[model samples]
Target chain A: MNKNFNFCIVDDDDIYQFAIKKTIESLNLTQKIIAFSDGEEALNFMIENLNNDEELPDVILLDINMPIMDGFQFMEEYIQIKPKLGKKITIYMVSSSVDQTDIDRANRISDVSDYIIKPIKPGKIKSIIEKLSMQEN
Target chain B: MKVNTNSEITAILATNNDGIVYQFNTDAETLLGYSSKEIIGLEKAPFFLIEEEFNNFRKDIANRYKENLDSDPYKLLAKYNGYDSREWTIIKKDGSRFVGHSTLTPLKNEHGENTGFLRIIKNITNQKETENELLRKNQVLNAAEKISMMGHWQLDTIADSVKWSSNLFNIFEVDTNQALRFETYFNFVHPEDKAIVSASFDKSIKDKVFYDLLHRIKSTSGKTKTVQLLGEVLTDNAGNVIEIIGTCQDVTQQRMAEIKFKGLLESAPDAMVIVNDSGKIQLVNKQAEKLFGYRSQELINKPVELLIPDKYKHTSHRENFFSMPKTRKMGEEGDDLYGLNKNGIEIPIQISLSPLKTEEGLLVSAAIRDITIQKIAEKKIIEAKNSLEILANKLTIQNTQLADFAQITSHNLRAPVSNLNSLLDFYNIAETEDEKVILFEKFEIVINHLTETLNTLIKALKTKNETVKNIETIMFDDVLIKTKEILSGQILKTGAKITTDFSQSPHIEYNKFYLESIFLNLLSNAIKYKSEERAPEIFIQSVIEEGVQKLMFKDNGLGINLKRHGHKIFGLNKVFHRHPDAKGVGLFMTKTQIESLGGNITVESEVNIGSSFNINFNK
Candidate 1:
């Protein structure tokens, strides 16, 4: 796995965040994992580090249910500032909702790479990492 | 008297003074239809007449000459009279009598003394018969003229005189005794028609041909009548016009009837086509001309099939209709009839047919009405109904989906199962007691969340299933008072000011528990989401909208960002505010309660300004 890659975890649930971070650490996928309690916190960090390549994540796991701002709201704001970022950011919608409406809505957004129902498996995380590494190659 | 022998007299006869047979000329024999050998000197004048007429004539002679009266009146008249003239009925050989005028004269000798008389008679029967025939013919002609409202006239061009029959004077309403001239007839012609009539008459005289014209005449009675003048010029052998004889017929009433019929035909609302028995178009109204896009003259004398579409041209029903015609509506049910316009465009039409009885024969009149608009309107109505059904089906599907979503939430098994799987994976790979313990703690938190979600889903499902059976007439003021009481602690802590107006619609028929819960949830939500920049000011009002009772809850609070969260505002576990007490189940349950009773809830909000929730209660 590429250790130079940065990953973002945006969720209100701390347990889901811990699990995702621990899984990334266990797989040795990256040491630069950044965590946000909600989409709003993640969006604030991205906007502040628009040109900071080292601080911005290459990949983001976004949760639909949050306190301040949800995944869909973050995507709306992210689209407006995405052109100013120095690197491409891959976003995956992660939620416990099995509702087709939510899934369809997430798929319809061009910025969302995919939708992963919680809780994501280690194999799924490993495939995501492998796919990113292949793209870089 | 000596009888003068002359051929000028058609017939003659002479008798002596003794009243015996004397002389009968050949001319008299021929006039009397007798042979000269049978009557000349063989019979006396009395022998040629019937005894009844002869005796009456003799008595009349005796009375006329009383001084010479004797036993024989003829002999006495013959002796005394110098001359006398009388009409005698002479019997013919064939037993037919003839009327003859005879003269009797006294024959004088050279010594100037009275002698035997000579009777000279001539037959004037033919002349008298002709006179009586002419009189009869004149009377018949007068009667004919009066009955037909026609009069005859003779213009003697050579004499420059005009003679009008008695009926002509009557037609002009003029005295018959007055002498009428050509100028008198010309003056009766209407001023507008005077020049034309005069020119026609002059043309006839110059060309020596027949003249036939229809013109308006203003009679002496101040009545205008349409008259037809038909005449022929009488020409001599040398080709010189001698006279002009004509008859004038009053055609005013006939013309008026024709005009009235035309007006009725044109005034009909539908296109009227009058066809003869041979299927030929005889007459068409203005509407028919306009509908078929053809001129009146173009359709007349043409086959009626020209207006029918080609598809129906060969239908035997058309021929059957003519064979046994009657008043009936055309086109059977589910059979569409169309008309072909002059431009060959097919147009939908409805037709009604009726038979017209006329002098020539029975004619069929078809009334055609265009139904293009009706067809289009029917199509539009069907299309609209189909679209409305489709929309209704979509709504039903969405409702089913909502139910399925509620079931899924109540199960709340997906997240817990996935979390347990992840935790088990972590425990299996932990290799350390601390790591396994950390994973176990996380499992507890996941279980708690699952249980909380399931409980909230159950409450929502209960609100949805409680269908409106507990409906009661609840007062808005009472509900507001109770809600205020329940939220008194928060209101005091936040210094929330609440105002209400329920005068317009103070009460509504709704479930009491649901209504109270709605009131409490909306009131607390307003205070809980209040903006810190100002004190909370909440306004509650009840009003009737579109015959439905509605409660409006408005507050000065940190309003929701509808653009981002509008679609999921009423969803279970959907939260927008960061308040510690925000559980996100209050509005969802409120919506469930409203929708379950066939009511609805809508919101209008601005960030950091205010939010208004409108709830319409079921009637």
Candidate 2:
């Protein structure tokens, strides 16, 4: 319970980003929270903080539909740079699609922790973080 | 010497055993035109005879008596015996000759000693001339029969005998010396034709009618000949058939020619009608009968026009055929030909005519083919092609609609609804009034985005459903100018340089609105995604590729990675570059507008070198 988690939200929907940030802040276990409008912004952030564990996110909530680089495209770029990173990041694909193709594609990526359909409940975020913390322990 | 007989009709003379004339009668003097005053003792029978004939007789007598006979009339005449009479060439004092019957006799004394020979000659020249004429006639008849390949025969029914002429024996390949009988003639008949021959003969005899038949006969040399036999029954005064006289002709060559012609006619796949020079149908094959629905006998001697439909009868090319006959298709002037069958139904037909030279005269053979099924099949093929075109068009439209529906449901509609749900969740959990107000504002933005997406989807669906009717000749340059005007703000901001060359294919037939929209979308995308290293340069040109008019929008801008995103480049809400205005709906909408009007949009690009969007207009 004393452990703090840094969370990242990569999505084009401003309202979803704001809601999820608020939800995570209410948990009291978040030490830092960052938001990117699309996958490219989040990927750039990850490359800039490649060795800085404190700045790097512990969990990434990635949206599938976006104006620019989508979540799947970001995952592709992320996988290529993942070996140089100082920290292991848990990524979850978040979409409102509910389309089997999207779900299947996200699941096929071994780096992706899970696919979560919107709107992601606050308890779901807690469980994801708790699961990650447990694995770390 | 003395002669034994003396008469006015006969001349008597006596010759010593040495052939010297001793006594001469008045009749002999009259016949020879020499008076009895010419001493008989000085004359001899050999003196009046031809030397060659006398010598020949002397040799014949010498051989018979086994003695050397001299040129004496006594030895030549008397050596044969008591009364020998034969034909002789007698010469008179004037050297005129007559064929005479001569008699020679040997006079013997009481001691049976041969004294001399007495001879008598008869005037039989008239009778000999008649006999010679008969012999000459018989030779001429034989020659005529051989030349014509015809032989005559007489069968005596009561006598059970057959008399065949020499030529008849030649025809049968039998020896001329062989005696002919009824059975001999029957044996020459071919085995296959035996029953027919027998029946014909029996019928002719019972009915007392003339018999005529054509049958095959195998000759003695194993050669087969087709013979035409014509027989006439001869009746006696008592009304009984006395004989059957017939003539047999070897007609094998003629028959073979006829059979070959018939075989060719029957083997033809098309109906054949052989017409004489007079335009009459001389013959018809089985196919002709079947096609015209008439018996062959019914068509023979009928005018060829009978089979033609009444509408085409006046256009008969009979005269043209007779004038310059050759092998050619009939009525090749692009007019369809029809034949009227026996049932009065007209059938489409193609005809070819060929000249047929026969012994009787010139003939034309017409070959006819029915094309009803072919015509129907041709019509069906055209109909099928039209239906296939329609089906392909429907499939294309349906595919576009399906893709639009998927895009709307999966991304555009889903994202905003989910954002609204998230905002509602935050609003429900807000602890303060300020937080609730913030959530409500976020809700408003999400709703507006959802509304905008729905409206754009409705417009795209309408474009897909509406049949494009506003087709006009649109200049590529005009569309580009209008698009530049609409995107002038972005063009000015990015310093995009737009150039065009519409000389190759200057204009296209397409919906003006769709053309404008396509131009607007492509030009804005070029300026919006301009490469930071250089000013955006877009070259819009109209060119003809493979006979299709293509409008190319090539840009030197921040191009996409086609290898990675080529599949979904025009997909709804699919954006590759991180740009603020990249909604990903412009290209999708442009593609939809183009494809709905039977055109298509394709993009070729590299990572950063450039991108080219080619629009193929409606053909």
Candidate 3:
């Protein structure tokens, strides 16, 4: 299961955050799951630990809508500092919006590996981790 | 004295003291239309006299000498002796009258007693008729000269004398009795024109050519007249110029009319070109020179078609115009016309033609106007109209997208539902009772969020669908007072200083509830996002902008960075600041309400400085 792999969740809804956390734990995907209520918080954490690969997550599930900053604003700031980061992280856009414009926009970013419409299934989460684990091998 | 009876030029007749005719000369017979045999003895001298004239002469002689000479014709005849004569109307043998100058002499005896009178008669009718014809012709010439305002003069250069006809004296306003010297005519020439006139006259004499010129003359009456002087130099048999004779015509009226016509042409707004019936350019005004880049002399006598472009040369427009001349525009509407200048550059032009009736013949005057600037303006107007249509289409598309966005945002119902789905999946996989109970608690929270979101969406929908029916004139001050009272706690807590000046446009016709709500939302927002370093100083004003009633709310607050979220400032669920009460619903609802009644709301803001929101009311 590659339990050592760390995952991050950026969303403003606490219930969705809690549900995703439980699903990851239930499959024993990782014990090092970190969550932020919005893109700004996750960005601040990533900036604070830019060279600290051990502190940074291997993957991030980003929400499109939030207070303070959204997924697109975070990506704009992240891309500027991406070359300085020690970890090669994968990003997925997780949004409740089925709008083609939002989906197409998130997919156009080279850093965004995939766009997933919520509710994101546990099966989708497991595959994401497994894909990362295969990459590490 | 003895008479020469063979003299053919004179008539000889003799009358005795007793009034007996003895002999009629050969010339007298021809002069009196009679032969000598018919009148030698058949008629006495009394028979030859015109009775009325003889009676008048007899009366005058009796009054003077106390002698009635009626029967004693010889006594009257003796009064006129040799070398003395008197004109007498003589009756001929044919009873036709002949006027004769007759002379008388006494035929005396050796004792010197008067025996009879000898009278000689000479016929003078031909000479008298010639004198009367000359007098009639002279009177006719004077009349002609007076009416035409023209006079003739002869200058005998050799004699240094000048003879002027009567009208010539009138033209110079000089006394007719005044004698004219050769220099007298030159004195009347205007001072400015004297040099030219003298030079022309000298040239004529030196060159042996005639002088014809137009010059001004100031008459003795101080009246200035324009005169056309034409003179010819006459040479004697030896080829010496002996005399100069000419006519001077008063052309003042013609010259004045010409000057006025030229002034009118020069004052026209458009270029004027006058052409004769043969299509030859006769004159061009100053404007034509400026327009075609040609001097007037260069265009004169040139074909008028020289100014028309070569492409238009084949049309025969000028020929058609001359055939039936009238005042009209040159071409059909929308027909592009061009002119070729001296520089060979083509210019867009408009032309109007009018016929000029002149003594020479029919002429056409064309007024040309350069329309290059007008053409350019027309093109720009068309381009502007096209761009405006494009912009209008873009706005329409943007409006459609905005409506779609509103619909999508209201479907925020999906976010909570998706959360519930995730929560349910987690519940099904829960192995422990404690974990299941926690998932249930989380489910309740999700459901509550879902309920709250649904309520908000429904309220937003209601706001969008609400028809405004309670329109009334609501004073801005009244609305502000009520809003302040409602927000009294927050105003006092924050120490917000709200000032207002609604004197310019104090009130608006708007829905009562909407006005109060708008005032409440804006004022609360001002106090809510005020800068912590300073007390909120909010300024509210009402004004009429370009005849549209507007309300402005300005505040010293933590203004939004419009650059970051300007497009979504009034969008649903779009919030900028991290205030605890920031729900992002107030502005969106305010915009929807204002727009429902065909009003518009716009905002200008700077971070940490201030925000000014302007609302334009429809009514």
Candidate 4:
């Protein structure tokens, strides 16, 4: 129910992207839900919208395994341009892998807020949105 | 005059003043080896006396008469008032001679006038001969003493005089003419041995007993000599010591030779054990004492077998060694010889034996060396090699398992499950029956694919687990032939030309099923991804690299961009090309099978030129 929040989904799976976007729309969590097939596209959007607070997403769901510029790689590049950004961003690493190595690597990055395993449930998304709203207050 | 008739006594005779034969004696005849009856009147003093003695006597008589004023005119009147005596050599009529002593007295008338001279003579030839013989014996004794480096001495305690033999003076390097006192001989004694020698001499004199002492002395020439003094006190009937006689011998050379022998024994590096022909230990070096942990006195004169190990104790090797009497190296022919120590510890050893010929008999000298450190080093090398092999084996197993887990997570478990989740969400939100039916149909397709991936993963996992137990010697040529048969349809469709050469390394010990699967996967992948611009050409060959068996699969197909996808080239569901049939499972399964058997799979590729997959089989 935080309709004012902006959401971003960076994943190469079209079906997962469609389901996550629909869930966010049904919950009335945000007016804008930006989607990227991979981490490189998501990073380019963030870099292009560095000065635009309204265009920047408040939350990004970053998938770990991708063809080009994976979730960890985006986090490395994002840190370099972070000081130029006009908005504060919260990132969640999303992956279907139950690998402890992937979870530990995502947690070691200070930029990544948490890790979520797929398929992400609707209730989990709602709680994440609620947690971000509380942070706003 | 009458002669003394005792034959052993002096013989006497007399002559008238007129120098005519007048007397003869039995003792005189016997001494002169002549008959007195033939020479009494026919011979006179002139006949029996030597010519020189008679002339000297006449001259002496003339001079004496001239000194006397009142005398008769006779020649015999010279001794009228005097008596004379002289020693004379007289010759008998037989030409034999005797040494004589004669005395002349005056023969006078009633007017006291000189009438005739009376002569007395004695033969003393035997006494002179006995004295000369005694002198010759003394010279011989002196020569023997000088040659033997020995000397004799006498201490006359009553007279307080010390007499040294001629050789004693030579031994002390002093003049033989010089008088020797007890203190003079003591001056030559070494400073350290002086007190002991003096004490021994005093003890001998008091105890009236024999004394033997070994002491050192410094000669007058500044050279030191070892002297052995042996003395016995001479006592009178009252048990009082009167004299002490002793012999001293210079033993410097003998002592020095003993010291040099001892030096050589101590300086040997190895433990030296010197045993006599009877197997008794005659001598041992310092190293031997330390090695056996026994003192020199403890081992000397003891049986040499005490130092031998129990197993070799009963052997007659010691007797055999003496019989042969030759130098030999022990343990050279790989015999495991050991030496026993004082604490009963058996130590590995190498020994060498040599025969020492001495005055006592032949002795065997054995030099023993410890080899514990060498044996330990050899054992450690073997252990380290075995440990290294074990570590390599464990690392290989862990690597294969990790790759398998990655493959399961990325492709087999995630792909279909994620699709099912997406499809279920679509079906739940569909507003029409047609849309729901379409979603269900997609669900069926996703589930079927999930089953297929799961099945493939199970097969790969089974191959890994059973790789060792199912291993057999497989030929690369046979495997290649089978793979070609399986992919013949694809090979013909793509116009792929396949060639093979397994001559270099034809066979390998590996799981047969795994080998066949690997070949099939690689061949089909090559044909499926063949370059469209040219006919696909594939070369399969076996080679040996760095002592490792290798199978090389090369194809002119669309290759991977190693720079971008090198790390995950063999990863499950990791595709580098956009081809419809590029499932990214063939390489993953091939890598799993190779690694599970302790082998490795590596690839080199360009974007489109070619790709070469090499599998190195572990021995």
Model number with the top lDDT:
2
In terms of DockQ, which candidate is strongest? 2
Report the C-alpha lDDT of model 2 over B82-196, residue by residue, as the tens digit.
3556777888998988877787788767877677878788767766777888878878888888888889999999999899988999999999889888989899999999999
Taking the tens digit of each residue's C-alpha lDDT, what string does model 4 give over B1-619? 1223322545555555555555667766665656777656763445667777776676676677664433332353444466778778878667877666667676777987665656666654555666678878888888888788889999998998998888888888998788878899889999999999899888888788967999899999988999888888889999888988989888787778887988888898888999898888999999998899999999999998898887889548887887787999986545888889999999888899999998988888998888788768868987998998898878766776776578576645785697688779778889999978877877877777677777777877786777345778888878877887888888788888989898888888878888888888888888887887988899999988889888889999888778767877787766666567766788888887887777888999987898999888884
Model number with the top TM-score = 2
Query: Which pairs of residues have clashing backbones in candidate 2?
Result: none
DockQ of 1: 0.21
In the range B1-619, model 3's lDDT, one tens digit per residue, is: 1222322257777655555667777777766667878766654545677778767766665555566655444454355432335788988767877677777567777876677766677766666677778888777888898888889999998998899889989999999999899678889999999999999999999988877989999999899999999888999998899999999998889899988999999999999999998889998999999999999999999998899888888537777887888889854368889999999999999999999999999999999999989889979998999999989976774575466455446336688788888877767777899988988998888788677666766765676567756789888888988999999999999999999999998888889888898999999999999998999999999999888888999999999888767877887666778777887778977887787676789999999998999998864
Per residue, candidate 2 scores C-alpha lDDT tens digits across A1-137 of 56888999998777778878888888888999999988878989999999999999999999987655778889889989999999989999998887787899999999998999988888998899789889889
Docking class of 4: incorrect
All models: lDDT?
0.82, 0.84, 0.83, 0.80
Given candidate 3, what's the lDDT at residue B112?
67
Candidate 1's C-alpha runs over 4 A off are A98-101, B1-413
Q: Write the number of the candidate with greater DockQ, choosing between 2 and 4.
A: 2
Consecutive 10-residue window with the lowest summed lDDT within model 2 chain B: B1-10
Identify the superior model by lDDT, candidate 3 or candidate 4: 3
TM value for model 2: 0.53
